[model samples]
Target chain A: MQYTVISLQGLSTENCQLKTEKMELKEKLIASFMAFENLVDIDLPVHDVRSEAIKEFETQGFPSKRDEAWKYTSLNSILKHDYSVFPKRDNHIDYNDIKKYFIHDIDTYKIVFIDGKYSSHLSETTHDGIDVCLMSSALTKTKYRLIIENYFNKIATKDSLTSLNTAFSQEGAYIHIPKNKLVAKPIQIVHFSTGNEAALLVQPRNLIVVDENSHVQIIERHQSLTQNPVLTNSVTEIFANKRAIVDYYKIQNDNENASLIDSTFVNQKQESFASVHTFSFGGKLTRNNLNFYQNGERIDSTMKGITIIGNKQHVDHNTLVHHIEPNCESHQDYKGIYADSSTGVFNGKVLVDKDAQKTNAFQANNNILLSDKASINTKPQLEIFADDVKCSHGCTIGQLDESAMFYMQSRGIPEKEAKALLMFAFSNNVMNSVKIPEIKQRITKIIANKLGVNIGFDL
Target chain B: MLKINNLHASVEDKAILRGINLEVKAGEVHAIMGPNGSGKSTLASVIAGKEEYEMTDGEILLENENINEMAPEERAHKGIFLSFQYPIEIPGVSVTNFMKTAINETRKAKGLPDMPANEMLKMIREKSEMLEIDRKFLSRSLNEGFSGGEKKRNEIFQMAMLEPKLAILDETDSGLDIDALRIVANGVNKLRSKDNAVIVITHYQRLLDHIVPDFVHVLFEGRIVKSGGKELAHELEEKGYDWIKEEVNA
Candidate 1:
């Protein structure tokens, strides 16, 4: 019952017991839900749904290494900070200061949030053809009530952190594409933490639905402005109807004090296609929980990621693709480069039901360690009850090829540039699949910058 | 232009090159012919500053400068090029881009700016054309899934582009067909000049028929046991290397 009793025993036995006692982050968040309910209407669906979610969080606190899903990543290091449950949102940022973080070269529909508050001046949301707007309006508006009630938390798993986000979170992006409609440009959802509090915790929720024969592309990012500690628990639900095409990208390049736990659930219907690409370059600790469920036949799911980190930073990618119908296919490829003392983990799972016959699944994870202290743990799990399914997986961990280095050097290329080129070649297959030219170009520049080289041309 | 003074080298503590003392003057093509495990490739790699090959004792002099302390790229900037037997496959980098990076890096080392794009393209066109390479081949990833003849031709194309002062071709004719062999040999012959030297290391006497050598040396057990004019290669070709091994063991 008393987690910090050992450290308290060494302190003075004072008279003020209330001041001496410290509240756990779990207890603070559970208590903050009450204040959260007071601000909104008491009789609305939000109050009851949030109350149920808080109960789930109270029952199951933050996950530990003992859990099978979190065997490699531990939340204890980030949970030790005394984060403010509610942060002030009076900070106004200059657009020029944060322009580099977005894909600014091309026009994009931006849904910008600063310190957990929606920024109207920085956002460009419209309701002319499709519903591209804020989650607050989606959750409260009468016209959006039925759509939200039907799809809002429908596909998300019952994970503890996701439940916690659903309990206390109130603001994020809500995108809905009508049937047979393709958005003119890509949409960017960016969350910036201003470091207004000593330490802050922000939970964001997003819901995206693509109707039949529609197409959509999305890019998401989280950035912290200052060095103060910040933790963000975000959840996103995506629905891809029949014959729809959806492409999603997650870019994690926050500062050292920032940590993120992102959970995304995707549902694909008959003859639909969905893909998610993650690029992780910087973070103190980042955990990605991505899941895909095939609802109908002949669906395609693809997952790809490239991670490069150093200096004690950590990143974990946990993904699952469930095949509920027959003739579905899934592909997963991830590459990581760790230097200094950084660590990484990749846990991918594929499951097929008994009736899901003739399914094909492939997974590959490759990593390079630039320093002896850097490490990675990769695992691929497959559970197939259908006898006609084909599943394959491979994992590799190695250093830069010595003979390749010597070969390049003999061709008059320096050691550093040669290494960067080899890394580019390592991740070339995944980079080739990016559809947006501007996004691909931006990612190339970021990869070059992360490698500390000035590569100005296409690979 | 190149001198190896009693060069002693080893890989993983296993002595591969023992007391190799050979001098190659400018404008001369020196053919090193030997059987398997005769240190022919080791000699080529040692001169190119391969880190895995430790030079235990002796010196490698290029144009009167000791290059034993230089790194591989440094040696390359000084105009030493090694055409590997199996060229590395660098995916996602086209042949043109690889050549541009290599040439620019060398130029940058020599206190010059990057070559203009038009001039670089022109040089690539000239070199590739001289080798009779297909224009479509230049845009593909460098050596990835390439045919053996294509790989060899690409290697020669790169050699022509760099134009090193001391060119060491290590078994460049192994994986090539006869036509590719002729084209590659012609490319090498065209790049020969009065100021640069060439060291041709091979196991078969077939490639020497095209790229004729001025001097022929027979290597056995990490040492050159016999040295002669071009007639020596013909003699070795007529009679196999068993005669050389018998002579060395005697």
Candidate 2:
């Protein structure tokens, strides 16, 4: 947010214009909710949920820096964009043009969207052994009503941005794996903003349910196609039943004019496992609110992220693990590399209930600032009510090792390439957790390119 | 051939190598023996163009060209190799892949195309086999989790791959067992040629027994106090560095 100078006498014309624009953006969204209500089925339970959510958004308004949770991130700058609350039309794009962003080297199920609407031509969904389809279908269809009534918006916290996203939740991926079933291939739910509007805000909601003894892998991304400003407020809800496993990855590499505030809520039953890996390398302003609720005993939760960014871009990773039952474990490891004037924030909070005993939680955040102006704010908060819990957290911020640089250079690698190699090695441990080869290859290329080195040989 | 004329260098504003003069001709092996903190490693680093070492007043010439302005990698491309006493561990970069990058970078500096993939692999297999390195070891991260002897062996493996015109072994034998010492010294001897030279920097005479030097020089207080034939190494080992200190103080 740009804080322009103001005279004590009165408001200037430019300041007035920006104020009205932001006010109009918020007012416009509130006004558009009424019109938006007419487009969907008012008979479903989600409609009431949406109605209540919009009211809560109206009461809370957009968050400011005053909120402790948002002390390091401010939305005042992106709010100035006069965003179109709802996309008007879908922009047709060729497959060749957008193919590079997908894991095209391998065969998988894809749920593609243009702006906020599903693009059937580019999607490869399945209903053979699992239900990998659209949320719109799950909401309006009669067969999915029971599941929707039980799981929709069940675990999402009622924060202002999440409430705003839920208020207009429509059109996103919905996957349901039955008991004793294993998804043969990974699922990629990619949202492409055509940037058809002068300024745009798209809200995509995803729901996933994995039954007992089931396993699934899903990848998510949000991309803007043009230089026009785009703001995305997305919410995803996942429920893992007993002995179920879920692996979800989010790739946030959008155009410089785009911003994203993604809120994900994961609820796990007994003996269930859920892991979320976020690769944040782009976007003008990105905030991830990931919350895991271990509602049952013996649940395992994992969170890992690698954020490499430059320019004026900013990324904030806010995570929480709530242990309500006993014998649960959670691990969080996030690494970031910031150059130019970019900034990053990592706020991880872990809470253990009084009744929960023998809980193990680990948190680590390490960062490298390549430029003097680049910065990072990291904090780890643990509130343990149980005396028998085990918790450890550590964070470090520093530059590259000079001796290591000279070591590589003396081996004939240039200074620029040597730095890239060290940076690549710094994040390589997290990459080891990825099971998919094609995804690994894509992330490797992105890291290499971002580090400004070709690395012609395989890693 | 490598030549240094009144070379003066320092690190962090502290003088390390003060008024040091040395010259090594091709086809000759020179041994630099010094006590602890005698600026032996500093000379190796300065010759390899380590940025931390500030060259205050000196001239380093390689093949009649002044190399004071060259970067470490640039000096490396000019065929000067310094085997570090303590090699840096770079995780996620396999030994083979690191050698490939180093070879390609040096070739690129010399305006040559990348070596063919098959030739590179063949060369790697031959050199690795010569150094008795396991095939599995080639794929592990460079120097990460490697034993002391393994790190020293890997340095020689790199030297074999680069085949520099001048090779400086900085305490390459400090951490090696008898078996590993013989293997590492054998690797260095195999690469030594009439067009290349070797500079062995060590504190003891055991490694000098394997990689025998033609000339031995004693460094005291950043200056070569005495130069002599190979017998000087035995005298230093027998009498210890106190004799050199006594001689220099006298």
Candidate 3:
């Protein structure tokens, strides 16, 4: 197979030298790669892949507004910060102090990271029947080298951010569910930035593989512990083999000083199912790049998200579902509530190939702008090449239903609470499909907290 | 229990309710009969303190307390309820949960604690049973995918749960069939007491046949043109609103 370098706009060879002359962050990152490599196992077989990825990132620097995919999300403002690429020392956090961040109500396998370094004291890994450990272990251990070689950095796109993450992919959660095994407890991948530096930048890479006739559920989150500036460029690649079931949930409720760029790539084999739910409640800026590729027949892919933000927060969701097989189905539903000067964007694209006959794809995005200044830009694109396929997309942007507000208020609910209830109810359709009760409750509480209402019951 | 004096309201500078005056005492059932665009619904909405209609000059007194400046929820806290003509479908909120929030919020406004779960369940069971609603209906989303009759029935069910001092039924009989009308009217009749009043706003006399009104007022061109005993509804039904228009013109 021929490999082509897809350079981001404005970062071609002609401008690369000029861009490098400024000693931008991209150049800094590339210049520091040698030191970063020396700190890790440089003799590993994955070194060549890392070298290629950094070169790719050097070729395609930080994406700018000129790029079509990055048009709605601007990095010019965030890139101005002189981020500390590496932490000076290891940071320690008491479990009791940060217990609220974890879903403690239920038992879960946790792989916790502090400032991009795996915290063995805070994590609970298992090696009984499956591999629920760190990527560093998987990379160095002889028993897991083959698996890591087969799966790591396999499905991620060649985008600048993803390549940046791949270049420094030293520590993250690595889970391998063997064939015909069922993981009883859900696995939680949490990355906490201690803000030890004035401004910190972390890239965490996660890999999950569920073999044939296996099942697994994973939850991932990125948190910042302080008010200092922190930016996280994370990538996750999931593979579901034949007849496998995988459910992934991402909770993005960091502080206003934190920004995240999450890129997730999912590949489904024959008769497999994969679903990812993203709940983005807080953050200064959040950009989600979610792509699903159906590789075999009778596969199911689902992507759902709910975003509620206020203040100057910005969130953009760019999703694509590529149907490459016959008799497969994909569903995408996203709901957003923007208030204050917040802005939201939803760009969903579904492509069905000619050979993918009888494919069913559906996409829906609905937004509610609570303030005059709050706005949303939503677009749903469908490119269908199969004549026998069923593809539909719907997009809606509007304010809360006035009549519904009156109806609730007439029932003695205050206007504030009424608005909160309506907003919650508007996103409830996406929440109803949450299979885990604890996660659902957590989401409900976050929503209630964001809405500033003491709703006693689960809406 | 309720009084409206010289009420003039408009929306976007278009007069919808002009000089509407009415009075209702406890233990009295008054029916406001009119044709479409006669402002029958606007009267109900204004009494419930809907903000869409600007009341230019009016006094809506509930038990002699001026409520014109109160919010809709404040009015509700003062024991005033208005059953919507077109009940809004609140998706994802079960009927039981919606009532729980409403009842608890009302109780909180009254400086009372949340109603106990058992007590709330009991009241829900009793009210839902009285309205002939199925047990399964209480668990579904509030009014979403509900039949027109089911929507009206759910509205009444909410009214029963609240048990307001004054309940205004706005076009409750519009989309209901005869059977649904009988059931709804029976539920209303059972809830009516000597301490609470009912103002039935309808376009026809069919609903009044089930729940007899103590008095009937014909509203024309945003004003109460005629008022009489229950016989006025029968007369309007026989003459079909045109006669009332002619009488107002003359």
Fnat scores for every prediction: 0.78, 0.85, 0.83
Ranking of candidates on TM-score, top first: 3, 1, 2
> Which CAPRI quality tier does the interface of model 1 achieve?
medium
Best candidate per TM-score, number? 3
lDDT per residue for candidate 1 within A1-459, as digits (tens), equals 001122445323431332222237888888888888877666768667778888998888778665899877767678878888777556788999999999998898999988888998888888989989999888888989888888988888777899999887578999999899988789999999998898988899999999999999999999999999999999999999999999999999999999999999999999999999999999899999999999999999999999999999999999999999999999999999999989899999999999899999999999999988888888889999999999999989999998889988999988888999899988988898898888889888888998888756466
* Candidate 1 colliding pairs: none
Candidate 3, residue B93: the lDDT equals 84
Candidate 2: residue A268 lDDT (0-100): 99
Clashing pairs in 2: none
Where's the lowest-lDDT run of ten residues in candidate 3 chain A? A1-10
The CAPRI category of model 3 is: medium
Off by over 4 Å in 1: A1-23, B242-250
Kindly list the per-residue Cα lDDT of model 3 for residues A1-459, writing each as its tens digit: 111134567546534554453357877889889889878888888887888899999888888767899867767556767888988899999999888888889999999999998899999999999999998888889999888889888899998889989899888889999999989899999989887899999998888999999999998899999999999999999999999999999999999999999999999999999999999998899999999999999999999999999999999999999999899999999999989988888999999999999999999999988888887888788899999998889988889999999999998999998988888889988998899999999998888887788986675
In model 2, state the lDDT of residue A312: 93
- Models ranked on lDDT: 2, 3, 1
Off by over 4 Å in 2: A1-22, A456-459, B111-126, B132-137, B177-179, B239-250
Each model's lDDT comes to 0.89, 0.91, 0.91
**Candidate 1 per-residue lDDT over residues B124-242, each given as its tens digit:** 99999999999999999999899988998898899899999999999999988898999999999999999998999988888999999999999898999999988898999899999
Give the lDDT of residue B19 in candidate 2.
Answer: 91
